[model samples]
Target: MHSRKIYTNTKAIAWVTIGTALFSLIFASGKFADGSASPLQILFLRYIGGLATLLLVVLVRRERLSAYRSPKPLSHFIRAVFGASGGGALIYASANMPIVDATALGLLYVVFVIPLGVLVLKEQLSSQHFGAIAICCAGAAIVMASRGAFTEFHMAYVFPAGIAVLGAALLAVEGLMIKMLSHSDRTMTVLLYVNAFGILLMAGPAAMQWVPLSFESAISFILLGPIAVTAQYCIVQGYRLASLSIVGPVDYTWLIFAGLIGFMFFGEKPTLGVAAGSAIIAIGGIMLAIIKPPAGEHESTSSA
Candidate 1:
């Protein structure tokens, strides 16, 4: 029993980590598609890609079409609304701002998730988890402030940065909804519905603004599908296997990954602040992996 709990917790951390890295790239890739397409168009293409990948997975498994049906249709709808809009906002902000700054701002959702989870889902926030999250947030503060890493805030970016915050808040609501869905839905079912609904939601807006894409931008958006499938699948499974408070801060890793990827692909330079802050963030991530949530309830629910 002890071993089983450890296994699920371990798997949860792995899923969130891998998914977050891939998701960072998905957002970073938004930078390429910016001018070539509107945020809606980019997001639409990405969803189309995600749904396509999911269907292929279904085909490979030879799963019945029925496997996609979920019991929580309204729940999924709310999640989709949040997912589509929040995602579009993030892409819009990412397209407009430096990738690291946009992402760090977007992570404001994780901070909100704890209280939101408590109020909405009645999830416990362990002291250990809260402390780790604080550490991560402190690191995030440094990342967002560092001249070498984050772009200095200017009134010029006020709109998109504000949009980024709105996006984070919406995604936080979406996270609570996902926690409810994860109680019963299969990971693929969770993602399939989100992509299906998200695609439907974006199609009209995206169509209105569709524009010709460069070869590079075209490939980048096309790749969003597989990345979406891989990342969302891992994340759903992680959520299924762990508590919200425990797994939510694991998202801090995305900020770190975004910083590095932004440096390589977007020419952002890193300095001592970036190095030091990231290390502190890494410590928090380690805390998440090692710290157990209150044992009994987690194990009780997890064994199912």
Candidate 2:
């Protein structure tokens, strides 16, 4: 049992590292896309690339699409809607904001997921979790305040912020669904459905806004899709090997990487307030992750 636990912890760290790196790549790619493409065009390319990569994986594993035959097609559809919306929001934000700022806001999904778990999944919430949420909110506020993100009131800022909130909600729902499906479905299958359905669903809106893609933009789009896929896969693997609370907080490490990448590539620097707030948020998340709720206590609240 001790050996197993140690192995699980190692896997968790690996997942966190891999997941963070891929996400960082995704953010960096988004920054790249912003320079040359529209959000819709980027979304279309991402999905197309994701779909192609998934198809190749399926073929290599000889996994039949029939294997993904789900009785809950509606659930898959819902997941797709949330996933697509989240993607659109992130891409939109990346186009307008500095990559780090966009990523910082996007990380709010961690805060959003906690309440979602409590209310939707009927999980219990502890005081520690509440404290964690509070900390994360404070952090988010700090980042926003430091960046003067609220003062501008421009579409670029406003739109992505809205999307970030929406994305967090969607991701919370996705977590519940994943937990439910974990009983019978493999993570790959769940991921595959989400990606495939997301591509199909987003294609309509994306097509409406479509512009012709250049060779450079096409490559970035393709790469973005695969990076996202790989990140999700790594996350799933991490979850499979350990408890959610253990692996979840490590995901927040993305902010650090985002900050670094933003500085290195875009010459964007976070202000003291943003840095301090991000630290608070990271601490709160870490506290929550390491805390084991009392037996029979839920880890979220109804208002989450």
Best by lDDT: 1
Clashing pairs in 1: 49-225
Error of 2 at 247 (Å): 6.3
Q: TM-scores, in order shown?
A: 0.87, 0.76
Indicate the TM-score of model 2. Answer: 0.76
lDDT of 1 by residue, 1-304 (tens): 5556557777887888899999888766546554666767777888888988888988998988696788788889889999888987887887788766787788888888778877986777688777888998888777667743354767878889999999999998898887778777777788889999988999898888889888777667867889878998788778777777767888878767877897998897887887788888888767766665564556423211
Give the Å shift of residue 164 in candidate 1: 2.9
Let me know the TM-score candidate 1 reaches against the reference structure: 0.87
- In terms of TM-score, the best-performing candidate is 1
CA error at residue 262 for candidate 2, angstroms: 0.6
